[model samples]
Every structure is written in structure tokens, then in C-alpha cells.
Target chain A: MGEVKHILLAKFKDDVSQEQIDLLIKGYANLVNHVEPMKSFRWGKDVSVENLHQGFTHVFESSFETTEGIATYISHPAHVEFADSFLAQLDKVLVVDYKPTAVEP
Target chain B: MGEVKHILLAKFKDDVSQEQIDLLIKGYANLVNHVEPMKSFRWGKDVSVENLHQGFTHVFESSFETTEGIATYISHPAHVEFADSFLAQLDKVLVVDYKPTAVEP
Candidate 1:
């Protein structure tokens, strides 16, 4: 019931354009204004030099104060709209969540 | 130049036991004590009810105050020891790092 961190990893479809990817990134950042329970959100392209990435190239992370806050953020209309539109452009996606007892301030 | 978040998504080899996973998780947390630049580390197994996870089932996230801090953490002996020993038990691993303009306290 404490703070929960949500991490999302995605690989865009091979044919997706750079412009579309830019839009999606901007769209996600804008959600902070609309989703009240979303305490923070940060995202970026993979920058690891390690050859271990496989095909995933992007990661987005957000934190919520509670489990219900996460549920609310997931079902929020803005989030749903963005996901509905972006899913087709993504070849793969991975979602993981956890409640951390120790977090950086 | 700012806060960087590193997220790793991985799937263990089918035969790996839960005990090993628990050990790896504890090992990462211990790095925060041994590695000076690793500001925080939090990890957990996948808990999403969504079907989008594919074959990945675990994630670990850590934050560093700068790019150099990240490099230090990656090359730290404790991190290297853990990664070297566990690489054989992992089927897939994805590493992503980004500098966030905004982060939750």
C-alpha cells in the first residue's frame, strides 16, 4: 500500500517513423497534468552500451503513492487513449511493478 | 549531468529456482551499501495482470546522480561479481538508462 513503481519497456514496430516515436514520448510526458495519481514519470531511449538489450529500445517509469493509485492511473482515460493509439506501433511491451521499501529521496 | 535511472528487465532460465532469484535481489540491495554512486536500488518480480509482459518477468531499477555515477556502479566489484555469476542463469536481459528531467522524491 506504499509507493509503487511501474516500469514499462517497449520496442516500436520496425516500420514506425521517428516522428511518431517523438509524438508518443511527448504524449506520455503530458499525462502528468491529467493523471493526478501519477506522482512522477520519466522515460527515454535505451543508452546501454552492453549488447544485452535484445530488441527493447525504450523504457518509461512512473511511481504512484498506493496500489489503488496505480490502478487509477492505468484506467485513466488519458492513459487508455495513449495506449490504444500506441499499441499498434509497438512490436513488444513489458510491464513490471513493485513496491519498494527503500527509495531515493 | 542530472539524475539517471537504470532499469533492467530479465527472464531467468526455465530451470532457475526461486531461491536464486531471491539471492540476486538481495545481492542488488547490498550493492547500495557497497557502491558509493548507486543512490538507490529496488527490484521485484512481475506482478502485472496484463498479458503484455512477453517472456520477461522481473525488473530492477536504480538511480544515479550523474552519468559517471552510473559507470561506476556498473563496474563496481559487487555488481560485476553478481552479474558474472548470474548471467548463466538468465535467458534474457534488457538494460536501459536515462536522465530524467523530473523525478519523484
Candidate 2:
């Protein structure tokens, strides 16, 4: 019923090269073109001043119009294939989906 | 030069009640009113189908106009005060700030 933000935080393996991570991120961003109901994809590197990030170095967020959209994306062949390679390079990963509720000023 | 998303993932301690969590979230959301450069506040419970959440249960996101804005927020008295009580009730917390780079379809 509302927009869902699929937030994923990842810590790449020490052995993985930056170039490989870039290619993997590119592959992830390209999924919006192949998946349905997935509205957009945005990502960024951690830039917090606080050291509370544990060990996560990157954040990948996918936007969907509905909860069902996430379900579809998970089962879609494109995501499944991408995830297989993506997960292999990550030392740790955390995925969470939330329907954002804005607090008015 | 770009908008930054200050993302925080938190897991409440086992003994904390739902009502207390609600109040904490309310206090968190209210920070926008007192802190400058904090453009918006939004949050949600983890509804992810994937069990990869690693134990994090809630996501709190605050939007800022720039990286400096986030720095200001980190030191702002309102935020620091809120973080004190908020962190006390959390079993774990992960924070990362990122500048969103959109991928065009």
C-alpha cells in the first residue's frame, strides 16, 4: 500500500578487489531495467563520522511501489542470478525492508 | 553537493517493551524539529522476507542536504541527548550515511 525501501548493508570480503565490487554494484543497479514493480535503485558508500557502523562499507537501496514488488524481485530470475554472485563476495550482509512513514514537521 | 541519507538500523534489548520502543521512536522523529539541516525523518519496522537481517529489526532514516548537515546533526545537542537514551535500550546499532546515486532505467 506504500513505497517500500529495501535496504542492504554489506561488508565485502578482504580478498575482493574494488574493481570487482564496482562491477557487482553495476550489475545490481541494472536490475531495475529487468525487474517489474521495482521503481528505482540507489547506492552509496558509508560516510558517517561515528564509528557505529560495525563493519559495513556500502549501502544498496531498492525502491518498490508495494510489498508484493519485493516478493517478485526476490524470486525473479535476474535477482536470483545476481544475488548468487553478489553474496559470494560479501563477508557479511544485512537486508531489511521497511515501508517508510514520514514524520511531519 | 548531494542529498545524504543517514540510515540507522537498531535492535532493541530483550527486556524493552513495545510501548517504550514507540516512545523512543517518537522522540527520534521529533529531532527534526529541533535540529537544523535535518530535512526529513522517516522510519519503519523490518518486514523483509529474507532472514539476512542479522538481528536488526528497525530502520530509521534521516535526510540531509549535504554531508556537513549530517556532521552538524551528529554534534547537535538534541541529537546527542536523544542518542544517549536511545542507545541505552538498543542491543545493537548500525549507522551509515550515504549520498544516493540514482541508476537510470
Candidate 3:
């Protein structure tokens, strides 16, 4: 199996400003340094105007070498602190992790 | 100004078998050839034991060269037909799109 990819989709609380979200995104980016299992991290704000999004406006994704790596990242103090401190600012969150499979395209 | 990523998370309906889902996934993989704007596609079954997934069991993501490319893909007949055919088998669906941005670790 390929490496596991952890995906997070979030809609910030109504009062959270764009500036705050930007800073939080940077904080997540820095998590790679604090969490040894974090292989790479990337994030962005939703740009699609499709009504299908259901209000989700931001997404963050990280790659881990294995499922154990995912567990380590989840249990890391930095990740826990980040979630504990800012989770209240999120209105909705959708998280899913998957391992890539070969597919012709 | 980086490429836009279109992410999809879904859980199949109670009656949908894994074999059916696999066929649908392969059908999706073929969309890249039918839809000119589709740059690349990847998908996988969810592997997280984290209760945070909220029952979302599969994810498919595709990268587009531009926001316009996304627009084209959305309006393509192949995409529309696929969604119309398989959407009824999805119990829950979450879709999000975002444009990549550089950030330091």
C-alpha cells in the first residue's frame, strides 16, 4: 500500500477572520517540524463557488509514511495543542485518511 | 496561483457492495481521458481508525491545471452522467476545492 494521506476539511466559525485562518494555516504548516511522523503538509482555502461544498472553506492535508505515523502525528503534543486551542473556532470539520491505490488515468 | 485540487469524500449506501464501489471508482478514473480539463486523479478507501472520520469511507481527489479547468470538468457530460448514476448510492458526500499555496515548515 502507498503512504497514508490525512485530509482535513473545515469551516471556520463565523467570527474567525481571514487573517486568523491564514495564521492558523501557517501554524499547521509548522507542525511538520514538531511532529516527527509528519512527512509533508499542504493547505489552502476553498476557492470553488459550487454550492456543493456545504460551507466548507478550508482544507489541510498531510502525508505519513504509515498508519503508525498517522497515529504518532495525532498523539503529538503539538497537534493536540493546536486542536485544543483552535477547534472551537471551527464550525464543522470533516476528516478522512486513505492510502493511495494504483489506478490508470 | 498553484493548481486547484478537487476532493471528494463519500460513504456508499447500505446496499452498495464493495465490488460496485470499485467499478464506480474505475469509472471515475476513466474520466480523466474523457474530460479534457482533468489533470490527474487518485482515489482510495479510507483506512483511518480515527472516529473522527464520521463514517466517510472513501475519497477521490483530482488536480486541475486552473480554476477554469475545474469549471470545465464540472460541466462535462461524462462527469454529470457519472454523478447522476452513482450519486444515489452515496449515503454521505463531502466535496471541497482549494488552490495550493506555499508555506514553510
Candidate 4:
């Protein structure tokens, strides 16, 4: 079975202002607007209205036919630029990059 | 294949103090320490030595026989108490509960 990567999650730094955070997220969204192998890529403000938690600022999902495709995506100049910009405002991030071990039969 | 729930991710509120954040995470970990069907229970400070990102504070992965099991975990009394304390300090959270459409052959 081809590898299927699931989700990418990131958390921003506390010092970053809301406006800067919003701009950083939107700008990165624009950059990844058309990456090959990125089956899906969408992000939004944290939705948890719960008191102590700020939902993850953004969650991006993408799938690739193989692991190599994901590696390339990570290193591509365009992606690096996007990552650099996005990383600037983030203080924390949690990324779980895994290919489904097997598709459900 | 029986339902398979892969991951659970959460983000805490901006105003959360570091001590409180750590306590919240540790407490939740203990609450779910013995739940059946859970394959994993772990949390950590974000790690992305690359500048600008703090990395996700914690990531938890658990497997379940069905979505309902995961739901049960969500509504369990211990979970609620843990969540209440945790949510009390969080500003946002994103929850994605999915069953593997097909386990790989």
C-alpha cells in the first residue's frame, strides 16, 4: 500500500501578537496553495471555546503516495520559505508525521 | 476491521502559566494511564530546535476498537475532571476523531 501521511500540527509562541499570527498563517496558506502530493491542506484559528485550551492554531492534512514525496515537500525551497516564515511566530509545535501502517481491509 | 482511532491532539490557552500547563498535562496523563484500548499515553514540551517554533507541547496517540471507546474516554468522569482542570487553563483545542477506512492489507 502507498504511504498515507495524515496530519501536521503547529503551536505558535506566546509573545507573537494575534495580528502577526494571523498574517503568518494566511501567508503560509497561500504558499502551499498548490503543492503536488499534498492531497489536502487547510488551516484555521483554534476552535476550542473551552476555557484553558486554545485549540491548535492550525492543522494541515496532506497525503503522499510515498514517504519520499513528504521528504521532498519538507526540503523544497518553497516549503522551507513557508516554514521559515511560519516558524518565526511560533513558540511551540507538535508534528506527528506517520504513514498509515496499513489501509483498513 | 474494527474501528481504529490513531491520535488525539490539544492546545492550551495563551494565558496558561508554565507550571499550570505542566501540571495539567501530567494530571491528564495519569487519568488515562490505565484505560483499555489506549495504545499510548505521553506528553512533552515542543521540540523544534529550529528557531521560531516551540513545537507542540504534547502529543498523545491511542488505539481503540471503536470510535465509541474513544468517546467513552472523552466523557469518563476522571477524564472530565482532568479536562476541566486542563480546559480551565487552555484557550483552544482541535479534536479529530477518525476510524481508518481500511487497515492496510
Candidate 5:
């Protein structure tokens, strides 16, 4: 299997309710409900943890079959609409992109 | 255990070597060799994938026992030094801190 092409790890604005968070989770997934070229996807809020991993609020990991696939997703109206709706509520944003070299199994 | 107060999730500079990534992973954990009131920490680089997670670079999750504990960690020299060393290499940084309301089993 090929490595995922893009990953968007994010955190919502403080004071956000679980209900709102859940809505966002589903909304993003629903946007590109069945776009091809994507291989994997997942979203999560920061969970209660015992140690070392306490501060993170949410993480959304998605993978594409190729860079072209990612570009398509970015331009797709559904994806754009989702981004516009979800990101509008965020305060701090950090986005990073990478192409993996080696695979660990 | 108290919920960790601070969380610093990050991605390193693109083209960063695996060796460098490993150094960062161990370094952060080593910095607080044995601090109290803090509970968690973990680091990882973007991994190869087949679909949605293709472009992201790396993620580091760190949590503290209390807001104060995190504040202390931030001011602590060892932690400071470690942060200085590692953050110096990061290009894009996304830090988020959240207190859990409902614990999930």
C-alpha cells in the first residue's frame, strides 16, 4: 500500500462543545464522502491521557494515493466548503505537508 | 491522575532525516528525565501512507499534570533547552491545550 498523501492535524477553538466537535467530525468526512485516490482517513479529539500526551486537542489524519489525488481533494468544492466551514471556528492553525521516504511496518 | 495542562504538537522541517527525528523524540522525553506533576509525552514523524495522510510531516504530543506543572515545564531550563534545540529545527508548529470534560472508556 502507498503512504497517505496529506494529513490535517487540528484543534478546535477553546470552549467548543462535544456536540459541535462531533458535528465537525462528521461534516468533514461527509464532504468527500467517496472521492477516489484517497487511501485512508481518521479524525480524533484530544483524549484523556495519563502522561506525555496531555495537551493535544484533536488530530485528523488522511492519506491519498498520490500527490495529484491530494491536489484534487484540495480543489474539490466539497473539500473547500468543508474547510471553510470548519476552519472558520478555529483560532490557532498549523499546517504542514510531507512526502514520506521510508516505510515502517 | 490530573489532566495534563499543556500540549505541544508539532511537525519538523521538511526533508528532515529519520535520525534527526529520532533524536528529537528521545530528547524531549529525556529533558524532563524525572519531573513531577506532569504525566505524558510522545513524538512522531509523518509516516508513509496510501491515502489522506500523505503530506503531513510530524506530530509531537505532550501533556502536563496541571496548568502549573506545564507552566513550570515551560520555564524549566532543561525543558527550555530541549525546546530551544528542537523547535529551532521546526518549520511549522501547531500547539494546542485542552482539558477533558467527559472521560471515555
Candidate 6:
């Protein structure tokens, strides 16, 4: 029952517009308000100097307190509905969940 | 300058032993001690419900104060030496850096 990070890496289709993507991102962020178990949402564009991204351009991260929280968020109607529009624009996507473990220096 | 999260997703080759991976992960996390700009490190195995991982099995995240901090980390001798051994065990790897933008509810 530890915290989990749902990390999604996405590559938008070549023809998708920035405006369309922006709107989708806004919709994604708004899910936090609708889904009770989802604690926070953050996202970013790839900025690595290393050319190792394999075409993924964006990263979206969602945090939850436990595995059940993630299960709740994924099955929530709000998330399901939003994912439809979100997936339509993506040419490729990678999603993974992990319980973050701090590494002591 | 904004803070950056350097995210790396890796899939180890089928032949690589779990013992080897454990050692490699230890080396990776220890980079914070050797590299001045790498503030923190954490990692986790994929626990996602969705099968969108594209064969990637683990996530490694490093935090930095700025993009330039990441630049210093990437070029530092400790990181370079570590990455060579790390990459040799991987079948595939994807890396991306991004400035985290919080989405307010």
C-alpha cells in the first residue's frame, strides 16, 4: 500500500496540432479534481541531451497513495472518458507504474 | 532555470541476471554521491495495469536544479563510466528530461 507513480510517455501523431494537444493536456490535468484518489498530476516535454528517447516527446506523471488508488483512478469514468480523446492523438504511448524508492546518498 | 527530472526507461536483455541488475541499479543510485549536480535518484519496477510499456521494465529518475545541472551530470566521469556498464546490459533504453509543471486542482 505504498505510493505509486503512473508515468506515461507519449508521442503525438505527426498531424496533431499544438492547440489540440494543449486542450488535451488541460483535460488531463483537470482529472485531479474529478478523481478523488489521484493526488497530483504533472507533465513535461522531453529535454534530454541524450538522443535516446526513441520518439517519445512528452511525459505525464500522476501520483496516488496506493495501488488501489491507481486502480480507482484508472477505472473512474472521468479518466476513461478523457483517455479516449487523449489516445486519439497519440502515435505511440508507454505507460508504467512504480512505487518510488528513495536512494540514500 | 527550472528544476528537471531526467527519466530513463530500460528493458534488460533476457539473459541479464537479476543479480546483475541489482548491482547496476546500486551503481546508478550512487551517482548522486559522485556527481555534484545530480541531487537525487530513485527507481522502480513497472507495476502498471495497462500493457503499454513497450517492453520497458524499469524507471530511473534523477532530479536536478537546472538543465545545466543535468548537462554536468551527463558529462561527469562517474556517470559516463557507470552508463557504459549499465547500457551494456540493456536490450532497450529510453531517456528524456523535462521540467515538471504541477497541475493545480
> Which runs of model 1 end up more than 4 angstroms from their true locations?
A103-105, B102-105
Compute each candidate's TM-score over C-alphas.
0.82, 0.95, 0.93, 0.46, 0.50, 0.95
Task: Residues A28-86, candidate 6: write the lDDT tens digits.
Answer: 99999999999889999998888998888999999999988989998999999999889
Interface RMSD of each: 4.3, 1.4, 1.7, 9.6, 9.2, 1.3
Q: Which candidate, 2 or 3, has the higher DockQ?
A: 2
**Candidate 4 chain A: 10-residue stretch with minimal lDDT:** A46-55
Instruction: Write out fnat for all predictions, comma-separated.
Output: 0.65, 0.92, 0.71, 0.01, 0.04, 0.89
- lDDT for position A6 in model 4: 40
Model 4 misplaced regions, further than 4 Å:
A1-3, A45-57, A101-105, B1-6, B9-73, B76-105
Q: Could you report the DockQ of all the candidates, in the order they appear?
A: 0.50, 0.80, 0.70, 0.07, 0.09, 0.80
Q: Order the candidates by lDDT, highest first — what do you get?
A: 2, 6, 3, 1, 5, 4
Tell me the lDDT of candidate 3.
0.86
Tell me the lDDT of model 3 at A35: 96
lDDT of each: 0.79, 0.93, 0.86, 0.55, 0.59, 0.91
Binned by DockQ into CAPRI classes (incorrect, acceptable, medium, high), candidate 5 is: incorrect
Over B1-105, each residue of candidate 6 has an lDDT whose tens digit, in order, gives 568999999999999999999889999999999999898899999988888988889999899999999999989999999999999999999999999998654
Q: Can you give the lDDT of residue B53 in candidate 4?
A: 28
Model 6: what is its DockQ? 0.80
Looking at model 6 chain B, which ten-residue stretch has the lowest summed lDDT?
A: B96-105
Compose the digit string of candidate 1's lDDT tens values, residues B16-96.
999987776777678889899988887767666566666778877788897788888878888899889777788988787
A30 in model 6: Cα distance from truth in Å? Answer: 0.6
Regions of candidate 2 where Cα sits further than 4 Å from its true position:
none
Candidate 2 per-residue lDDT, tens place, B16-92, comes to 99999989999999999999899889999999989998889999999999989998999999999999999999998
Per-residue error at B68 for model 1, in Å? 3.3
**Clash list (residue pairs), candidate 6:** none
Assess the local accuracy of residue A28 in candidate 6 as a C-alpha lDDT between 0 and 100.
Answer: 94
lDDT of 5 by residue, A10-86 (tens): 65778777799888877766654656655555554544333333244565656676667777777777777888888
lDDT of 6: 0.91
Better-scoring candidate (lDDT), 1 or 6: 6
